[model samples]
Target: MLPNYFNTKPLADYMRHDLNIPADREAGSLSAGRVGRIAALAAASSAAYAATGHLLALLALLPAPAPAEEGDEDRRTFWTDLRRASGASALLPANLRIGVVAALDGHGAGLATRLLGAFGGMSTDQRVATALLVGEHLTNGDDFPGPASTTGELWLRDVELTAWQIIHHHRRPPTRQAREQFREAWNRL
Candidate 1:
């Protein structure tokens, strides 16, 4: 049986209620506005961008999530089953190659999408920091929001591999050192 807390809204409802998504916009039009921004990054990491965007759309179907408890270990290990079932890298960082790891639970994917939408209206440098934060939250370890689907499990690995890549490419810095500085500044923020 599915958990009572899972997100169960239709795309239109999700678009309306989602904090990051625009309520007035039609669901199909999401790809043109805020969500479109992420899609544009598909030029480089097509697989990653496509998978992450798909994952976000799937996640949007879920119900709103409960607040994560502080320092919740179960939350950190949330993606364990999906990771194993997909035969993805056991080393979280290896799957991400940057960081692994979210209170984010069911809401993480959607939040990440919104964060990419001009990164909460932040400056360019601040946006990179937002991506780094998204990578950390997504890879951090929380399991799936509710029960997993066969398709969800199957693509879990690909989602893990490229979600961050899509976010990273959105506001790519001129150099590695510059990106690092953004991370540092974001931490300060």
Candidate 2:
């Protein structure tokens, strides 16, 4: 359990107000239920991957509806909705998180990256909370059964690259070049 002094309100407010999560969502609440769920999801996803060695199968637990055609707008909508519904539960092990985001349509993937970027300036507690939320969202169970799509694999590569950017932003003091590059990428998206 987190220390009593580890405040989560700022992070929850950012997710709800800045990231645009619905005010009604439990993720936006200050209650321990939300934090507990985030921690539980992270621990569970980590344990599952350690035990099974099948990240793909674990990611498959999340709902990823296939597009009739690649890059379909409806599919993008599905991913966006999925992100909203799952909240910060989408951040899992690197392999699983990358797979889930890569499976999204371009717009959806862009949104995911944007959300990660938002974590760049937050406090450590907030970042931890955000990571937990994202991990849980992606690892949360669904009934869908199938391998990740070819497009998803290809997009996974891209997400991996962007995720590194997020890590750089979070782990170190920002550099001008890194900030500029991040802006350029966000603009392109």
Candidate 3:
């Protein structure tokens, strides 16, 4: 069960912290120790995110957050909105929703899938961040709203479509069409 006071902001912090895992850094003789620490932190963050749903909500969820806005309330708010938007996208289809969030990490979709599998499930904060990325990317050249809840559907579609566009930006319409068709077929269940 989740902590009675858990909420979204700390959860988001945990998500960011987890994703910041220095997979590339050298794990010395303390490799096991390091991995354990990273995993624990990641798991905690994941759990927090899972508990809170979004950071703004997390602020209210956690029994008692730091008691200080940390002087970056605005930044936190932006991230919270991002998470909500991206998470909404993830609601589309398991594969595509996860795929878009993972893909935005600057690595390939395969890596994203692997990470998700390795982590098992995303914390609520993590989900929100993923949704936000997809949502922001898809809403290209448009203004995203503040605070209140918005639909993740638009974000989900936009992320998938944008990813397709990026991959086939240089190709002709036929190639793009084939890829889109394949994606649609795959997403159909």
Candidate 4:
């Protein structure tokens, strides 16, 4: 069984406190606002991923729809309605997306912690999975922590950018190649 405190706090706590360098930014380090945003984004993304996974599983049980013919307006309308029903939003600005990714690249654990918080509470297994996914996707392989330059930040920035891109792309009917790429990227983490 998990501890009560662990279940109540967002998963991001693990990453921020234990993973990130300086962990809690002091006066000269990163600002409170930046850290807070990263934490919040991470938490939100994690929750969304979990919820979406459940939703897709339920959807899979239903009968498959017929393939749309070329330029089928009805197909387009159906997707439009479906997306509207899903209610996912494009929340992060592009610049911030880049910055967060950069942070993840340099500090995978820190990034994962922020994301774990965003994901909210989960089983120990779930938390670990979420952390691994975020860390792998965001940083690729980079994992050094220190003062962040724009160059260094850009490397990590790809993770956030990829997340956003995935969310947006998933809304549409992805091609086989696209789906394969997405799965491969995710499986790597």
Best by lDDT: 2
Cα lDDT tens digits, model 3, 48-154, are 22322222221222122122436655444554454354443323333333433333332232422333342234566655555555344434444545421233434
Model 4, poorest ten-residue lDDT window? 1-10
lDDT of each residue in 1-189, candidate 4, tens digit only: 111122212334444543454344464565777667666645654543443333333223222333456565644454343323322111112212442343323312333333323334344454344334333333443553433333223432443443343344224234456768999999999
Q: RMSD of model 4, in Å?
A: 21.8
Predictions in order: lDDT = 0.38, 0.40, 0.39, 0.38
Tell me the lDDT of candidate 3. Answer: 0.39
Model 4 clash tally, residue pairs: 16
The model with the greater lDDT, 2 or 3, is 2
Tens digits of per-residue lDDT for model 2, 52-170: 22223333433455544666665455455534433433432222344344323111233335444533445555544433443444434452223333333333334445454433322
Q: What total of clashing residue pairs does each candidate reach?
A: 17, 14, 20, 16
* Per-residue lDDT value at 61 in model 1: 32
Candidate 4 ranges beyond 4 A from true positions: 1-33, 68-189
lDDT of 1 by residue, 24-135 (tens): 5455755456576434432333333344455455343322232346455553454443233223333232333222122022223433443233223454444344333334
Instruction: Quote each prediction's TM-score.
Output: 0.23, 0.21, 0.21, 0.19
Task: Quote the positional error of residue 14 for candidate 2 in Å.
Answer: 41
By summed lDDT, which 10 consecutive residues of candidate 3 come out lowest?
Answer: 58-67
Q: Report how far off residue 110 is in candidate 4 (Å).
A: 32
